[model samples]
Target: VITSENQLSFLNVTRSLEDLPVEQGNDAEGLLNECKEAMDHLYKADVYQSFDEPSLFIYRIDIRHNGSIHSQTGIVGLVPVEDTESVQILKHEEVRPERSDLMSRHLVAVGASSSPISLTYKNDEQLDKAITNCTSNEPVLMTEDSEMKQTIWKVVGETAKELSELVSNKILYITDGHHRMAAAEEALKKSNKNYGPLESTLAVLFPDDEMLVLPFHRRVGDPEGRSSQDLLKAISAVCEIEKSDETTPERIGEVGLYLDGQSHKIILPKSNGNNLVDQLDVARLQEHILAPIFGVVNPGTHKLIDYVPGPLGINVVKERCDKDSWLGFVMHPLKIKDLMDVAEAGELMPPKSSYLMPKPRSGVFVRDLNREKNIQ
Candidate 1:
C-alpha cells in the first residue's frame, strides 16, 4: 500500500549497489559518503573490472511471462548528454525535481553508473545485419533472471564504428528512464567538479518496431464516499457505460472498469479533436471522471488513486477493490506512434500512462566516471 501508513520510502535498500548511497543518508554529503562506502565495498570485492578499449556491446534479452514471450536485441553504449540537440533524444514524460535530484546526487557520489537509459529508433537494415552477424557467435556472458534472460557480446574496432555510424544521426526516443536522463543533465550542471564520464551516461538502443508496450492501469477510490450506483450515474455523463465480462481493456478509446464485484466497460464520447493530450484515455479518465466526478485535481499526487502496471493483470485490480472498496480502471496501452506524435509536438502524457515490457536489467555494463576514457 502507498498510503500514508505504509508509504514507499526513499531510504530503503535499492535494486543495485550504485543506488545504495542515496538510501543511506538524508543530506547530500552523507549520501556521497555512503556512496563512497558502497563503491569501496565493490572494489574490495574485486568486482570492478575494466575493458582495455572502447567497445560496443550487443545484448539480447528474452522475457517469458504468463504464457507470453517478448524479446529484443540492442546495443549498449555511452550516450553523450552534452550535445542534446545533436543527440536528437525525445522524451514524452515530464521529470520530477525530487527524483532528478536523487539521481544527480547518486551519480556524483558513486563516481560510476551502469543503469542503461533505454532508447528506441526506427529499424535500420545495416545495423540489424551487423547485430545479427555479431550475435551469431556464442555470447561472451549470459545470465538468467526471474523475468528475463540476458546474453551479451562485445564488439570493438572497425565493427563497433560501423554499428555506431548506422545509428549516429537517428532520433532516439526515450522508452524509459526519464528521471535518470534528467539527472544526468542535472549532474552535469550541478557537479562541475565531476563532468568527465558524467558528461555522458550509458544507454541501450533498440528498434522501435520490436519493442513491447503494455497498459498502465489505474485504481481509483471514492474518497468523498459515494455509492457505486451514484458513481456509475456520474460516469454516464461523459462516457457510454456497458456491463462487461472482460476484465482487461481490449482497444483504444475504451477502458475496463471494475467496481464492487462486477466488471464494466466505458467508452469515451467522440474526440473533440482538440488537444492531443486530452484524447489520451488516461487523460480523458482524469478530465472527465477523476476530476469532474471524483474531485481528484491531481491524480499524480492524489490519495484517491494508484497505478498498477499491466504485468500484474486486472485480477489484481479486482482483488484491490474486493479488499479495500477501491474502484479500478484498466486502460488500453497507448500506441507507440501516438507517443511519438505527442513527443514531437512537445506535449506530455498523463503520469504513469505507459508500462513498457521486459525492462533492461541494471549493473550489466558499468561506466566508471573516474576513468577519462569511454567504456571498452
Candidate 2:
C-alpha cells in the first residue's frame, strides 16, 4: 500500500484517503469521498465476506521458531465494549490518546473490523472440553504461512452456545491490540449508539497459561562527550556489575549490558513492597538506572533510548550499540503472573515491557464489527 501505485494500489488508495493531509482538502469531505472509493473497491475485491448465520469458532495457531513449537487455541467472537468497567474485559497497558483517536476515526471510516483484538483469560476446563469436541473432525479452514500454521473450526448451533456460555462469566485480559480495544470503546461513546455491533468489538480469546512473553531489549546512547566507561560507572553505582560470558539475560533483575565489544551483567536491586508494578525489572531499570543515571525519564519518547523486540534477540541490541549507542541492555522477559498481577492492581507496565510469542497471524481470521446483535 505504501509502494508503487501501479500494483495492488487499492490499499494504497485507502491509506492515502485515510485522514488526508490539510493541504489536500477538507478532512470530512475528503474522507467521505475516499471511503466511498475504498469501500467500493473492497466490495468488488471480496475483501469482506459475510456469513448467513451468526456463529463463533475455534481459532488455533501453531508457530515454530528456533527449533521450538508453540501453539494457542481460542474462541473468536464479539466482546461487549461497555463491559470493560464491569470487570469482564481488563487491559494492562496504557494507550496513547492520539493513537486511540486516529484508530477510532479509522473504525468509523472502515465500517468493519478486519482485525481481532487478542484477549486472554484464566483457563476454563469446560471451554477446553468444548473445543476438543469441536476439533474431533477436520478443520473447516486450514492455512499455512512461512512462519506458522493455523487451523480454524466453525462452532455453530448448540455447540457454539455451550462454548459461549462456558466463558460468559470469565474475565478477559488484553494480551495484545490494546489500541484497537480503546478505539472501539471510543467509537461506541462518540457514536452515541449503546447497542448493536457498534457497542461491541471482535476479539479472539485464549487461555493465559498458553500465551508466551518475550524480552523487550533497550539501547541507550551516551550523552554528548560521555564515554562508555562513564556510562558503566554510572550504572555500576546502582547495580552489581560483572563481566558476563553471554549476552542474554538469565533472570529477572539481571540485565545484560553490551558496550564497546564486551558484555557485562548487572544485577539490579531486589524490589520491595506490595506494588508489583514497581517491582518489575523494567520499572526498576527506569527508576534506578535510566531516569536517575541516563536522564531518560520518559523512555517511551526519549530520543536517547531505543527498544528492540525479543524475536531479534540480544544481537540486534549489540549491533546497534556497536554503531551509535553506548549501552545495550538485554532484559529478562516478564511472566504471565507479572502481567496478571499488574493488571489486577490497575497499574500499567513500562513501555516495551513484553513481546508476546506465537503472535496470531493477521488476515487469517477476521470478524465483521457490523455483525452485531443483542449480546447479553
Candidate 3:
C-alpha cells in the first residue's frame, strides 16, 4: 500500500519525469531514460519478487463508502495482445493518440508493467465457485488503509489451469485502462518480432455483477465572463431549471448544477437520436447544456471543461467552484447494463463517462516482459 498520506504522490512521481527543460529538445527520450533509470534502481533495491513457477493470483479489494462496503474479486494474469484486435476483448472509450504513444514508449523502456488493465465479463456460476474456493484460505499478502483493504492469494498447478480454462472462451469488456491496452498494441505493431513477451500484457478480470460504476461529473469555466443569472437564463431556454436544496442528482434525467454558491435542478429533455450513447445523461448534458450554452463542443480536450469523479462527493466540486469561480454539474451514475449494451452495439461512450471504483492497485503484481512466459 502507498504509505504516503498525500493523494498526489503518484502524480508527483510521474510529473518529475515530465518536468524536463525545454532546451533539451528531446523531452520524450529524456523521459524514457529517466523511467529506465528508476526501474533499474528499484531492481537494485530488490523491490520485486518472482514466483517459482507459472501461477495466477486472486485479487480482492473492499472499499468502505458511506457506511457500506463494496467488495470485488478477480483473477490476475496476462492477456494476449492479439485479443485487443479481436472480438474477444471490447473497448467502449476512445483513446488519445499522444497518451497512447507515451505509454508505449514507457512500457518498452522499462521492460515491465506495474499496472494491470481491468476487464469485466458476464457472471458465470463455475467461475464464481472457483474464485470462492480460492479465496477461502488465508491470503498470501494483505494490505490496507483507511478507505480500502486489499488481499491476494496465489493459485498454481491444476487449480490455476482450471481457472484459466474457465475464462478462456468468455468474451471480456474493457472497464478500465483503455490507454494501456492501446499502448501495448502500438508497441507490438512497432516491434519486428511477431511473438514474445510483448505478445501479452497484465490484466485482472472481474464479473460484471460485482463491478461498481460511478458518475463522472463535469466542471466548466465560462470564457465569456457571463454571470450566473445570465448563464441560467441561457440554459433555461433548452432545459427545465429550478433552484434546489440538493447538490446531488436523484435520477438519470436530472442534473444538479452548482453556480454562484447555489444549487439548481436541471431536468433534461429526451434525446432525439436513436443510438444508445445519445440516450445517456452525459450525452444529454453535452448536447443540450455544454455545447449550446458554454460553446464547449468537444468536452474531451476543451480548455474550459474538466471532469471530476463522483466518489469525491459534491462538496469537493463545490469547493473547487468556490475557489476557481467555475460551475459544477452533479450527474447520476450509469448502470452496468447500459455500458454492456453500448459496447455490444459497437458504439463508443463519451469521454470520461464513468468512474469505476476499487481499481486494481499498481505494484501489487509486476510483470517482467523479457523474462516472463507468454500466457497465450
Candidate 4:
C-alpha cells in the first residue's frame, strides 16, 4: 500500500507493473504535485482502502535476466535508532547528512516508503532451512520478473519464530539504502517533538551468501578537451602500460585504455600498493594512472577522464570514448571477500563502486520498521 503518486493505482495490495510508470528524476521538482495526485487518487479509491493501523510483512524479489535469476525473502520492519549501531545491524556505505535531511523530509511528506533498503547477512543453516520450510506451502502473492516466476509468503507464527531465531545472533549489512536509513535517523532526530527512538523506520534483510554484489561501471564524460595521447602520457608516468591492439581488457587489475582507436592494458607493477586501499585495482589505477598522469587529485572532478567497470565490458567503454575524449578506464571486479573485509573494517568504498544485483521491489510487503519480530 506504499507508492509514489505515479504508482498510487497499484497501492491497494496488488496491481500490474504496466499500470504506471516509475517515478523518475524529473519528478523530483514536482513533489507537491505528486503528493497532491497521490492523495487525490487515494481519496477517490477510499472505498477499497484500509489503514486501520501500521503493520509489517515479508517481501521477496525474484528477477531473472538471461540465465541469471535470484529469489530473496526477508521481513520488513522499522529499525529503532539504537538498533543501528548495536551490532544487530551494519552499514556498508557512508551517507551524507544533507541527503539524509532531504530524504527525511520526503518520507514525512509521503508518509510511506516506496523503496526498501536492502540489508544482507551471512546465512545461518537454521535460517536457510526455515525459509525453505515457509515456502513449502503456496505463496500469498505470485509474480514474474521477466519470465521468472516469483512467490512471497506471509509469515506470522512458527515461520516468524524460526527466522527470528536464525538471525537473532547474526549481524546484518546494508547493501543499499544508505539514504533511507540515514533519513530515518535524521527524521527521528528532527521529529523528537513528535517521535521517539522507536518511531519506526523501514528495511528488508537477507542472507549475504544468497545476495549478489555486482560492479558499478563508471561512465566519465566530457573530459574538458583532453586528447588521448596527452592523457596516456600522464598515465604512463604512474603505471606500466602494456600495449595491445584489442579494444577490450581481459584480466584483473588491468585497465583497457582506448584513445585514438587503439587499446592498451595499463597494468600496475606488483610492488605498487602495500595496504588495503592501495592494493585495490581501482586505487592502483587511480594513483598510478588517473591521478599522476592526468593531474587529477580527485576522480570526481577529473575533467580529463572517466571510468567504467568490468561488467559493462569494453563495448560500453568504447562507446563513451569520444574524439575529444582520449582515455577510458575500466576496473576489475571487486571480490566478495574483499567487500566483506571492507565492511568488517567499517570502511566505505568510493561512491557507486559496486552495482549490486537483484535489487528488491518495494511495496511487496512494507516493513513498518516498528515490529517486534520477523516471521521467516
Each candidate structure's TM-score, on Cα atoms with residue i matched to residue i, is 0.90, 0.90, 0.92, 0.77
Pairs clashing within candidate 3: none
Best by TM-score: 3
Most lDDT-accurate candidate: 3
Better of 2 and 4 by TM-score: 2
| lDDT per residue as tens, model 2, 1-376 | 2424543344433353334666876465466456545655656788544565768878888888668888888898888988887878887888889778766787776665656888888896777778889888778788887888889888789988888889999888888889889889999888887546778788899898788889889988766547778877887888899998997888887888898989999898866545778899898888888887888988988999989999986778888888875689889988987888788888889888998867766555545444444333
Clashes of each: 0, 0, 0, 12
- Flag the better candidate by TM-score, 1 or 3: 3
lDDT of 1 by residue, 73-103 (tens): 9999988886455548888898889878877
Residue 110's C-alpha lDDT in candidate 2?
61
Better of 3 and 4 by lDDT: 3
Q: Candidate 2 regions off by >4 Å?
A: 1-36, 47-49, 272-274, 369-376
Candidate 1 segments exceeding 4 Å error: 1-32, 85-87, 192-194, 271-273, 373-376
Q: Against the unseen true structure, what C-alpha lDDT does each candidate score? A: 0.79, 0.78, 0.86, 0.61
Error of 4 at 61 (Å): 2.9
Per-candidate alpha-carbon RMSD to the true structure? 4.7, 3.2, 3.1, 5.9
- Worst 10-residue stretch by lDDT in candidate 1? 1-10
Tell me the deviation in Å of residue 339 in model 4: 2.2
**Model 2: which ten-residue window has the lowest total lDDT?**
1-10
